[model samples]
Target chain A: MDDRRVAVVVEDDEDIRELMVALLGQSGFEVHAAANGTDGVDAVKENDPVLVTVDLGLPDIDGYEVTRRVRRFTDAYVVMLTARNEEIDTLMGLDAGADDYLTKPFRPRELRARVEAMLRRPRVAQAPVGTQAPIPTSVPAVPEHGQGDTAGQAAGPTSAAAGSAAAAPSGPAGRTDGSSADARLVLNGLVLYPHVHHVEAEGRDVTLTPTEFVLLETLLRSGRVVRSKAELTRILRGDEPDAGTFVSESDERTVEVHVGNMRRKLGDDPRRPRWIETVRGIGYRAAGAAETSG
Target chain B: MTTAPVIDTDALGRLGEQLGDPEVLCGFIRRYEKMLGQRVERLHHALNTQDHDDWMDAVLSLKTSSAMAGAAALSQLAAELQDYLAKRPPDPVRWPVTDCLESVMAKLRHLARETARQLRLFLNRLSASPQLA
Candidate 1:
């Protein structure tokens, strides 16, 4: 168990599910594949894998619910996959106990890097003498490993078998304020920094205009649902609170034109988008969620 | 026959403080010249070929490039040019396009030269504005 790292991939699509498993397996992870949310929950409960990736568009239970459920039972990293590449969905995913999210049709390497970054985080060891953890004092205390009967404890052969059991009392041991300094978006090998406004693709920095940088950040933050052009313009300009919605109609059109230009600079394809994708009648979203661990 | 440049470095440096990276001023100078040159070259080709789509593309690129580089005056000028072209009836044969092109090109060159001079005084030497040259 300690010799290998295990990652659970819960996706309904046969091809995507198989692809994820193969990708993770090739990247030095023992892959556990689940077809739906229910099976995924069961697999995590049994496997105690170090990381789990859940797709939002599950056939049975929604992916958000799966994240919530799994979060309650284990400390394994939960990365949600959503098709609605909107800003709200990205925030909501974080609120639902997801460590990170990536939109569908993502790059295999990005997904693999996210999993590795999550695993590399030091799980908070049971409150050491000097460690400052807020574990509730009221819960009946169990030994160092944890309460054996606690639902959080999984019984399966651990992914990295020897002693890779996740640390107790999950809740992003090393993260703070829902943001990591090193947190960044990597799509199709393009690295975008949220705070720095820097983009690097194929190991070279791609300079973006101020507006382009703003647009990219907006897409990354909201890559789970379709963001209307109006909403985007308003966000960019910070228009009046109640000044009327029609003010941004022209700005809305500009958003599309600017995005078209941005796509050209990023070398993204609209016909078969491998990065920023267009939603027929709605708006644009970052299609790739495969982020590298910065 | 030089006219007073429209870009005021004092105002730009103040804006840069709010925008972070004082070097964005220099960035504006470099990018505006590079993009303006490319757009002018492209527009010349588009005009020769009578390609409305190519013309529009050139104008759009110029507009966005200026806006991003913090060349507010130049961007406004480009926007006006774009609006005029977009709103005016197409007369491919009688287009007074050369006049508009020369006017903007001259303005941009003056701005670029002025910006370069200001960068030398303020950024490199960290000095106040040079007395009216």
Candidate 2:
């Protein structure tokens, strides 16, 4: 079985497309290239790539439409590459289901950093056979304490559980069977399985992009503690929360958009959010049980 | 008057490093040259026919492809043409003077040629470098 990663480049411009193919190929991905949206989507379907870089402008269909189409079937990471650097374009691209966005003339180092940061997040698990996984309603065994390294390193379930166990005393709640219950966080009918990278709202599966999944998991684990947009941006970038990394306004806006999209996907209205609440000038937090019970 | 570089060698160098293989980078440069020729032809046809939509497509393509290939001057020229075409009314009667369009096209052609020539030189240097080879 070929375990090498696969990547698809959906760019109309031959130069950019070839550059991406070569770059991804060097990065150990089996690279496939398509020059138009139609062929791009087709290539994605056939290849089942783990990463897809798409250009905003295409001959047959736009990148937005292509992203929406790809989102229907796979959770492959989508990165939008566009010459248009306008804020509206960035917002639209992210809102249309792209996992990340890079403006044209972007430095290769910048692109590599973005790609590396995204790949650090755990990929979503394949859909379970038969019935959907049950949502755990018990208290979460892990609080995801510490604002930095712990959250950054807890990419998979075992690591998160292991970290939590090391930090907190192992009570009777600790399972000997190694069930994912130790890493599950439940609030107001929204359940997040951090170990398995799955979420369920009101007993129905809620599909989130890997970024959205991590954002929701972070908010849920924080309980009612409000996380600032800058902090969230750092978290999304895989930077330590307290690191001196400069979080640009665009990066903060991206966090806001991801949260907005997450709310939409979970069917939680911002005005009366049951899963996530806006903190006005600050950032976002999971809505308290008291607030949602009303 | 100072002139902007026809090619941003640093950008191409970074791309070469990211690609890791000298041969792959040289092949990309060759493909870029071929694609540049096709795009230039398309731009000339668009200008001759005054097809606003075709012009927009061709110029936008050139701008993005040139930027990716590190053709700084050509990409800037394409961007100017994009802005110019965008501001003009679609009606041919309201279009800019023919001579002005001709001058812009001539500049675009010259820049493309220079950018391609510099890329070829860069490729040759890379091919000849003992370490890279």
Candidate 3:
């Protein structure tokens, strides 16, 4: 029962697996890792981690299948590790319920920065209600071990885990609506609670990965104005949403996949979508969204 | 006149840092050395037995392992082998397949030597680092 957030890395290459384990460990996550799909799923179920980074091709059933099974049970953010040439699978991966995709031969710093950004966006669903996380709520601050900077061993989980876990309620900082995370956004029958990052589609609870949640939030906040894939990736990258650099085309595909999955979770057909509408080569927007933020 | 770098020392150095210990990197090098032989043999076995699926799997594993060990050039070559094997011939012919595998094998042999040298250099750095000790 480690109170620190958990992360599971499911990659076949030992080098990559070990790298993930080390990277996540240093960044305050209690990391569990595996070399294949079956074991990867097993670890996911056993740990119920807040984050799970999976490789696209595994020794057993491949990453797409692993994410499928995980999505059926838990909503842990699934980041797929893909080879650069396997850009095509990025779509397949999203269709299979991956939250994000990382090209292989990735820079360690880039991975860390990406993970940090993802962790910053709250994971209210995994916080097991009736618990209060400290300020800097979503991402625990990076630990600085006694030794000056990153020299020798990094202080994994110590500095980040410094927040006292004894508080009573689970809620983000300031809520315009109320103190109990009742911040709600409505798009007809679809309902989203901004504070807790909760979503309910047509009376049934919809399990959204962190990336999906952010995408949904961005669309809702933006109203009906069309957002390009470049804009969305910029949002995902923790950059100013309106501003974007040269976005990769694969990034656009990644958005398509995620939006596709999000639609499925909302039980909306792409043929004639009811909740999220695709703008054809532009990006996506929430259908008839009405925001009432306090 | 540029000889394509067999191994990316920068990648190797980054990997060494991620591993946190040069000795751990040395361990991977040893395992990679052994796995390369086994994977190459497996590829040959698949090709000789006309097991295209198995051959694909072997080459993919080789490619990933090469990338993991920072053998970018070799990994690229293995990826080419993967693409080539993906195009299955209707008739299982024993011609040219051996030639293709041999070329990849030659590259792998060169990469293995380069990988060994890089690991040696990384290990020496670890020994010199008072902080690591």
User: Highest lDDT among the candidates is held by which one?
Assistant: 2
Least well predicted 10-residue stretch by lDDT in candidate 2 chain B:
B87-96
Candidate 2 C-alpha lDDT tens digits along B8-27: 88877777776667777787
Q: What stretches of model 1 exceed 4 Å from their correct place?
A: A1-3, A127-294, B1-133
Q: What would the DockQ be for model 2? A: 0.54
For every candidate, C-alpha RMSD to the true structure in Å: 21.5, 8.1, 9.6
Model 1 scores a TM of 0.35
Ranking by TM-score: 2, 3, 1
Chain A vs native chain A, TM-score per candidate: 0.47, 0.75, 0.68
Q: In terms of docking quality, how is candidate 2 classified?
A: medium
lDDT of 3 by residue, A162-271 (tens): 22121113222222354344456778777776544457677655656556777887787667778788888767655555654667776676777777767776788877
Model 1 per-residue lDDT tens digits across residues A1-294: 144566888986554566567667667778898988999989887887767899876768878888767754455667888654455666566555565577653544557655654554333222222223332332111212232211132212232211332322222211222233334567777776543334556655454433455567667656555666765554444332133546344445556766775676677889988778888777887785545354
Off by over 4 Å in 2: A1-3, A130-207, A243-246, A265-272, A289-294, B48-54, B87-94, B130-133
Q: What DockQ does each candidate score versus the true complex, computed on alpha carbons? A: 0.01, 0.54, 0.26
DockQ winner between 1 and 2, please give it: 2
lDDT of 1: 0.55
